[model samples]
Target chain A: MSRHATAEQLSSYVDGELVGPRLRLVETHLVECQDCRRRLDGLQRVVAGLHRLEPLAPPPVLGQDLARRVRLEPKPRDLLERLEEHLRSTPLQSTVGFTFALVFALAVILYLFSGWVERQVLLHQPVLVAPSEVGAGAAVRRVGPRSFHAEDGRWLEVGVDPRGAAVVAVDDGVVRQLLVFEPELEPLLDEGVPVVLAMEDPAGGPGRVLEILPTPPEP
Target chain B: MEAAESTAAALAQSDLDLVERHRYGDPAAFEEVYRRYGEMVYSLCHRLSGDPDLAADLTQEAFLRIFRHVGKFRGGSSLKTWVYRVALNHCRSRLARRRLFWRSLAEPDEPGPEAVDPGRSPEDRAIAHDEGRRLTRALAAVPVAYREAVVLFDLQGLSYEEIARVLGVRLGTVRSRLARGRERLRQILEEGEPLAPESSP
Candidate 1:
């Protein structure tokens, strides 16, 4: 043990961590004593030596990796991330809106092309009312004869002649569905013509677009 | 304090203002804080870890961590203490992860801190480099408990309270550790070098 002060107290005194009177006492004692003075000098020298310690550069890759991670891993995910991800794969996906748009566009195009095809084909032949008339008994919705309904929805495209009805110049589902409805226009439905339709949602508002397709030509 | 304009008190606000600016989408403020503490952090890390490469990594890691989690740095300690804590803890983790644990007492480092002042002429820097090596050896030889207290109190110049807070220890413990560390270091340095502890009164 030292006479003047403990080694730790002297260390505290040098560090300025020792409080007012205690720090003063340590300083005063150090001043009077040669040995304590020498110890102080030694400690100071040690610290001075440490002050010489040079700064090392981190491994080169550490800096590069940290910078890369900072840039790449910038944003932390918000709470809603899981929900947003889940919604992407659902049937109510954003692409559904796009697909409906495609379907609606195809339907209108088919509607227009059907009219054009009708004008082209029906130009030569007359609008022949079939001899065996399937007469309506009474009430009738006076929509146009050339009409369509999407398989995805109950949406209907009204106003087209079902008898010699020409669909999009798509011979697939459109033709198959038409064959079930009107066997007479089945041949016309077989030739697919990429076209659009007017989508009439019966449970709701004014008709919007359905989709695009080409149906078969009427024989 | 109401009457006193304490710089230490303002330091937390300064950190918040800078952190707010940094966190609320201003990167320049972050740079400001980095510039402010860069050298201090480097010095602290360098002292804590004997390896310059590790120190630099830790230094950068400290700032980078601050950058990453600056938003979460609640207004508790002044920015200086907070930063020191972060840097120190990170170095500790690195040491722990490496398992380069202090063996009973700390082992004397075979090598020392890296010297980057390549611009200095050999003669100009040799004395300082030698001192640095001696200190590093002495530090490495010290018990880890004392080593940290000595480094923080003596070299980096943090207060006992600050060291206490940073090390999560009592003030008494800080004092005791610092004293023991200095005593150990004093012996290591003055070995037959015409220095000795005076006889106690």
Candidate 2:
């Protein structure tokens, strides 16, 4: 208050930042100090000039671009709400329901066709009839490496004259037929064992397996 | 009349209500907030950075950041203070990264395009334009920290406490910065050295 006001005090005074005693002190000093008054005037002019400077207008596309970007973003809250709204409309609801029905019909058609495809695969490949299917009891004997004859009057051979193929022959009194199987049955084809060739599907490819029946030994 | 009244009502809504509406997915509320504060933010960036293009970019980035983090805006401070804080922080980070490069680039002194007001007398417009150019040049010469304080306190009319919050500095620091900034601006004007043209990074 006694000496000329400092530049900080004058600046704070011009900004009205100083309060109470400090404010009164600067106001008192400004009355007698011409140099400080001129300095305060300069600072005030600078602030006024800055305020008068106009702001640059933003680009016209800014708002539109921002809106588009915001819309494209996935809004988890709005998504459920929009879906519910869509479902409330009867036409859209019916259209969606019809689409689901079409998908179910296609699935049924594919399922029925799958069974036909399986039958075709069975006919082309060798069909292995179980030993019991040929007759209730039939004694079988191996005639060759890939051939077999059964007491039920059926003959069996490896359809393709391959070394590892399975052949189950049955010669029942009524009829005789040859049954060929895939190479996977070779391990189970034992002489004098009541083994049944099972036409079960192989996991890797189109093939079948042979099962050895558990027959009780004669006392 | 009804529409105007409704607009006034909307404007009167508290910042918290507007922000909450935006959080609840009200696009109009967010747009209203943008309309209310966008120009002020743009002007702050323009003064802080002498380059108009960088200012525009900074302004857009600030608003995008605000939109992204609206949920985190607790009502600890007024929305205006928080927004100014966001804008100033962005400007500071940008300035820090480009400080050396920005100083090295020298530009020719040229006034940017000024929009002439048809309503104002030619003499008044001319004087205003000249004053604006001089002020802008002088501000550019001030050190960034001081310039920020002066621009916010004097031009943007923020209180000392609000500036402290924005700059994340002590009240004393704000006072010193504003004082020094004013003095530096005055000296630059008195010396009559034409302010170097502002260059964008």
Candidate 3:
């Protein structure tokens, strides 16, 4: 290996991923190269120091504050209602409507297929899936706009809007159960209890973890 | 302290119930949300934006956005994450609109609140704490991207996985950016040197 190992290689070495021949090569380089050795040592120190930066306590009133926001956040039922009204009144939209419909259809097909596949895989694979993917737009989503009840709590709506649809009971009345909409979850978890934002496998739906936030529960 | 803790405990149940009711269209729910997240959001904005007054404005705007979009929130992310996303997006947009110079100011430089100690010398403790502040300042010296990375990862103690989610980047990208971010932070804080220009997008 060249004495000038790239930053990636150095990072791998820091994480102890460099192996066998590469390991020995990096070792030899570090022994002879003071600069690389210094950087590695410095990083170790900095990381250690970072771990010690006093954990900030959210203002004592933080939990109440988080809960307040959760309660105050407005719902979009009216927007969905308006969309339904518009769609009903227009009967047909031009290119924009058609384009939205096309995109919407593709998304639904992809979501259903992916959701089915995910269910099968989760049953077989022991991987502990986290809720990060729910927010990751690029990830394979398991629901389509049509099937997935968005925030409006509407189950089905035309034109990518959430209106004119029946409500699917989300988790024993926990609509959108997968979202940690609770106000206390924030400060409570921030205190360090790892929170799992789980949606009730809306029977006939998928067990999706929307997000996980860890806040240590007050002792 | 005991009273506060007990009050926090008692408040938890009513709080959760109120949020659910609000989501169900209770207009009173908005008032509760405002009082609850108001300070915390303000504090986060204060620290991240380094301007308390500006943080207040951003916090108010953030709440408005949260209220408007709360209905769109699927139960896939933490309410914390959801609100945080709102606050962060607001901060990002605000930074985009502001002078580049203000963006780099790192929390307002006003001497932090005077330590409330009497017998023990506050100046001595403050001077020590100032080291931590210096670390924060060094972080501010970096560009917003690198600063956010460092704040989210190092200062905030987010897991690389979580940081990646927050920054919307691949895992490998998170690690590299963190490394570069930390390297830059270390240089500025320890070496008293300006950050070397980075080619990061």
Candidate 4:
């Protein structure tokens, strides 16, 4: 009680932040100590002077520019960044949130990879036309890779030969006919659309195309 | 008091909602936050940096940091305190990097932008303005640690608890800083010292 009140005690006392024995000690000391009382008074006036300095208005353009910048800022795109933000805001524990995020990223990767593989397989495999074995005029439908069947119990297999030529072979009970189209038709055949061909020789020949219809002839 | 309490309650309720909206890409969310705290932030930056232009730039940077990381706000502290913390940290780091921390105040004779108020008569206003300017210079002379405590508690009217949270320090630290800051400010003002001697860190 005989010692002068420290600057911290005086400051906290002015703000009512000091409590317990320290607060009482300061209060009692100030009553007996004229110099401490004057020092306390000086601190109070300084605080009061600071209060009188009103807050400054920021330059007007700051808000407009900041809003524009905030609007233009791209949303967080990194998956890990998004996950980190999620983990912060979520109620879940850090371990659980991290595990959840990892599992989600893995699932997304797996799904995308599977879709990519499926697309690759489909692009590489030759298309099939599945039509019942009937006759030459029957509508040809893709049945399996590189082959088609007619309603008259005949089989027609289509492919591009190693020489880069379009070849179609039709087989019934005994006779087999191979029809080859010009190389120009090879790219079009890859499009997986139905094609109708009119053979110049009914038996078979290379580079024979009297007519080519993209769609099956109507009934 | 009642009105202030209710306002505080409403702000508290909306703080998380605003964070949610910002996270969900609500364009207005950032604007709303800026509208609410823009001046407060600018004021703090200005007082700390003592440069209007630098404060303006720092204000923009601080808000951008807040907006970018708003999703990380988890209602742990009131949005206002969180904002003060973010803005203060930015100001400190930037000022530190530029070696502007502990920079002496502007020439004592130069009138500050805030020197005049149209509402007051010329004679009284001049006297008040000079006092205000002197106080500002004295404040600028104080070290950054104590200066921030004084500015937030006295100038900005933050409670000790709020100041503590904004400062990310303990309550005892806040008490000591405010006392020491006020004592330093008083010494500089009374002795008319151009700048408080920077204590060796």
Index of the highest-DockQ prediction: 4
- Regarding lDDT, does 3 or 4 come out ahead? 4
Top TM-score model? 4
**TM-score-better candidate, 1 vs 2:** 1
In the range A1-219, model 1's lDDT, one tens digit per residue, is 237778877776666667988888888888789988877877766655555556543344544565565665464334365357666766654677888986999999999999899666423221112111213221223223332333222222344433443232222212123222234433444565333444332223354443434443459
What's the best-to-worst order under DockQ? 4, 1, 2, 3
DockQ of 4: 0.38
Pairs with steric clashes in candidate 2: A152-A171, A152-A172, A153-A170, A153-A171, A153-A172, A154-A170, A154-A171, A156-A169
Q: DockQ of every model listed?
A: 0.26, 0.17, 0.07, 0.38
Off by over 4 Å in 3: A4-29, A48-219, B1-20, B26-44, B100-108, B111-128, B193-201
* Residues B1-201, model 3: lDDT tens digits: 999988756665555565566567777776666665565456456557765456556776787787776655654544555566687788888866785324444344542332244444656455435554555566567766766766676656566776776667898887777777767765665576322222211
Encode model 3's per-residue lDDT on A1-219: one tens digit a residue: 565655555656755767999889888888888888777665554544444334333343444554466566445465568577677887554688798987999999999999998676433321122233323332322332213322323232223322221223343334442332245455666676665443434223766554445633469
TM-score of chain A, predicted model 3, versus the true chain A, to 2 decimals: 0.32
CAPRI grade of model 3: incorrect
State the lDDT of candidate 2 residue by residue for A47-137, as single tens digits: 5566566554555565665666656654424556646766676454458778998699889999999988876654434423345533554
Give Cα distance to truth, residue A196, candidate 2, Å. 32
Quality of model 4 by C-alpha lDDT: 0.72
Error at A185, model 4, angstroms: 20
TM-score of 1: 0.57
Candidate with better DockQ, 2 vs 3: 2
Go through the candidates in order and give the clash count of each: 61, 8, 23, 16
Candidate 4 stretches greater than 4 Å from native: A18-24, A76-81, A84-219, B1-9, B106-122, B193-201
Model 1 chain B worst lDDT run, 10 consecutive residues: B192-201
